[model samples]
Target: MGPRFQNNDRARLYREIYEQHGPIAPVVLPGDVPCWLVLGYRELHQITSDPVLFSRDSQLWNRWPEIPADWPLLPMVGKQPSILYTVGERHQRRAALISDALAAVDPFELRSHSERFADRLIDELCGRGSGDLISEYAKVLPALVLAQLYGFSDEAGARLVPSINALVDGGPDALAGRDTVKSAMSTLLASRRAAPAAGVASRLLYHDYARDFSFEEILEDMMVNIVAGHQPTADWIGNSLRLMLTDDRFAASLSGGRHSVAEAMNEVLWEDTPTQNIAGRWTTRDTQLAGRHIAAGDLLMLSFAAANGDPQVRPDRGSFTGGNSAFLSFGHGEHRCPYPAQDIAEGIARTGIEVLLDRLPDVDLAVSPQALVWRPSPFLRGLASLPVRFTPTPKSTAGGSR
Candidate 1:
């Protein structure tokens, strides 16, 4: 067999490919899955937004044994004919229901909850002086929020983060281990059957849509919310912290300036979005993308990092300031990330980081920069551990009594 799926330096690889091949290149995955990687801004939009030529449904590759029948995995969760994977009319309806939940949530209430969670997490993290920011703070905050938003209990929320992490960090072994995670998810779903939280799951479980969705379908949808929304959301916060701490100018813009923390995050996200690559499809019969022919059935891989940094679309921008349009860190078109309204996800993230900055504004790295380990995952873009010593700030009354 060819070498096992080794973790390649994707940052360097992305830059080189874009420079050399000019965005779209035919490459074979280890499993011999042939697809084209789209590295330019325009092509990514064309391929991801298209539903006809490209399919989000894993069922398209059902005959390909190397790819699981669950090939599309978490993205395919909550799949009614109306689910995201479903096309045309069905896709639209399911997307609408999901969108309604996002629209229905009170931004103020969401921000408040996010702030409280961040404060609690920071308090715990501050005590350490140094810890794996990802595990200690970053992972818990967003996962818990997503869990609450998706109608799981506080206890269930606490546990679900690990289950979600296992899937992302554990690779093929963990993907194959979904049965274990599914068991816990089932109990939570069933409990919600009786005592559902007032959130997305409850809305979908009892909505007019409920008539068609089975328990498994609902559980799958819950999985999507947990994995897609929570993991990356939290990762971005942790990653942003690392960036601010390392890059002096970027760091100063956050710590010393009048720039809104949201603007700082937009800069970090422009410089570094969590999603490195995404696999997607074309909607029409055939198309030319980045000067390459794309037939229906051709899969498209989008490099968010490359596109975000593309010299053409990305303006000659400096540090994020007000009245600026940053890169598409949340994505573009119909499937853009629906969080951070007036800073929703960033509201949560900034709450935590602001507290950290205030507490230890002039912290120093505990170890050499090169010694820090980056999270070894393809999708997530962040460090695994961020060790820094800082001068702790005075405890705030809003921060719950320790």
Candidate 2:
């Protein structure tokens, strides 16, 4: 029998697979589909980008048992590169709509909003000595950023946060229950119809839908964009914060103002990318990878963490320090994240971390690393709850220190 299925600790399992197989190994998953596990840096890029060998369409995984039609094992993945899942022309068109908006963003404007949200969350954490970063802070930050960007009402944005979180967690109910999100989208669309706001939704309402997309397609595209912007961005903020907290040297560097935390945030993404598993095409013909033969019709699992950690690509750094920045957490090659709208979310989260660190000089994680609970979903990696404590220095004193 092959290795037992490991849940959240994929880094461990991936390492074992690499050591045993020397990069590519024939493995049998519980579903009985034969797969060649690709772990090396070069192999991952080659297989993932080779259109002839692998198809992103899920129709290829037709024989798998765990995947139910209502609950796709991987929803809309590889089917098309529609923004996150798309490739070529479709990818370019969908990405173009949002990319310009991202490019034109004023960093100072985004930083101002992030500061406001961080202040409110800090106030909420005031009297209490500790709190769950995921619920209290990490969760609200992205929704507010996306909502403000899209011109959605505060109430509408707040309502959709949990629903988007559920969608990230993934299940049949989770997939079907996105009606809440649809309702919010419909309301926003209607409101924009009368009085358009200067956000992505409004832009989509006037630009994409009015021209290229049908009314129904506009709704569908908006629904995906809103949640896509919110979920992974939020997850990354939380994960990166936890990582920084565990390594004080890195956190201090960010807070110290010596390095550009804005740029370092990209490295944080490369180090521990929020999303874990990405589904792609099955090879239509026999292919050689890392010197092993992968037969046609075999599915492959792409592990970003494994690729990011590959020594061949990333240089050896001592003890997870704060300065190393070349990580694959942001993804690379054809499917790399577009980071539209100025890569706003990561900037916001970085600002929050910097502000928090500056104010609470003594703040640190309150529990052991092993005790921390990672969300069970294998597709993304993040802490379920990050409890932290800090010395409550007076704002006046904190300001003076800064």
- Per-residue alpha-carbon lDDT of candidate 1 for residues 52-126, written as tens digits (9 for 90 to 100): 556676455422445644444333221333244656666555566666665666766666667666676667756
Give a tens-digit lDDT track for model 2, residues 123-194.
Answer: 678557777888888877777767766777667666677777676567555755477777777787788878
User: In the order shown, what is each candidate's alpha-carbon RMSD?
Assistant: 4.3, 4.1
Show where candidate 2 strays beyond 4 Å.
1-10, 27-30, 60-87, 171-177, 193-195, 208-210, 251-267, 314-326, 392-402
* TM-score of each candidate structure, all chains considered together: 0.82, 0.83
Candidate 2's clash total is: 14
The model with the greatest lDDT is: 2
Q: Please, what is the whole-model Cα lDDT of each candidate in the order they appear?
A: 0.63, 0.64
